[model samples]
Target: MIADARRAVVRAGVAIGIGMGGFVDGILFHQILQIHNMLSARIPPDTLVGAKVNMVWDGVFHAFVWGVTALGVALLWRARGGSARVPGRMFGGALLLGWGSFNLIEGVIDHHLLALHHVVERLGPSVWDWVFLVSGVALAATGWMLTRQIDS
Candidate 1:
């Protein structure tokens, strides 16, 4: 039996948050809105072949995210038989923290560093990237606050 232990199964929640957040970003911003793709800034989807390539890369990205979400689900299932009581706030906080972390890390790595993609390709490297990062920060802060009180 896995004990909730000192961490309160935060890892599970965080993983879930990360997966969900990434999906929203990828689906909403990337696909639904048709704003940007994984390699939009690099290869671009201007040509038919380019669009196909971007679509493939986008699928790859989603696959990875799906794996992340599956991991989170596994963690939660294990925690169900644990010794400690998982707090609602703790879960939520961890979730937000995970989302924020995703935005911050992804934004910095892909947008700023590697130049794999931009927050909004049409807008170029403008306030969109900063906004993405800032939103992540806000989510993280909120999660931090929520997790302060140990429900257990």
Candidate 2:
């Protein structure tokens, strides 16, 4: 029925929004910031011998992140019962907020304090990295708050 269709669309939109937030984190940090890639594994510089090995692992890691995000979206869709619910929204938001917070803290500790990587290496990386993290947290908090409103 038309109502069902509308519900389905709404649910899908919520899932997509959350998933897109995750995708943006991965893309901006892994690609644009160039601080780190999706994978935890590190790749040696291209000047190093066997650099190709690192490249291969990097590609695999990025693919894994993409797959995980897709799976998460699918799971959210199922859990929300074709409709966005308070619990689902809150939980998803919390999860993403945690992830962003972790990244922000870790990046500061490892890259800034530890000097493992420059804050801006060749270009300005830290600025956008923080922005991405903050945006993610905001989205998650909004989702959580929306979930609460629906619940009440």
Q: What is the C-alpha lDDT of each candidate?
A: 0.84, 0.49
Candidate 2: pairs in clash:
none
Estimate the Cα RMSD of every predicted model relative to the unseen true structure. Answer: 2.4, 7.2
What is candidate 2's CA lDDT for residue 41? 32
* Cα lDDT tens digits for candidate 1, 106-142: 8999899998888889888989999998998999888
- TM accuracy, model 1: 0.91
For residues 1-152, what per-residue lDDT tens digits would candidate 2 score against the true structure?
Answer: 24444344335444455445445644675567655532223333444543455446557755655665576567556655654442544454445544544445545654455543433444434575466456546755655454344322
Per-candidate TM equals 0.91, 0.46
Q: Which candidate gets the maximum lDDT versus the true structure? A: 1
Clashing pairs in 1: none
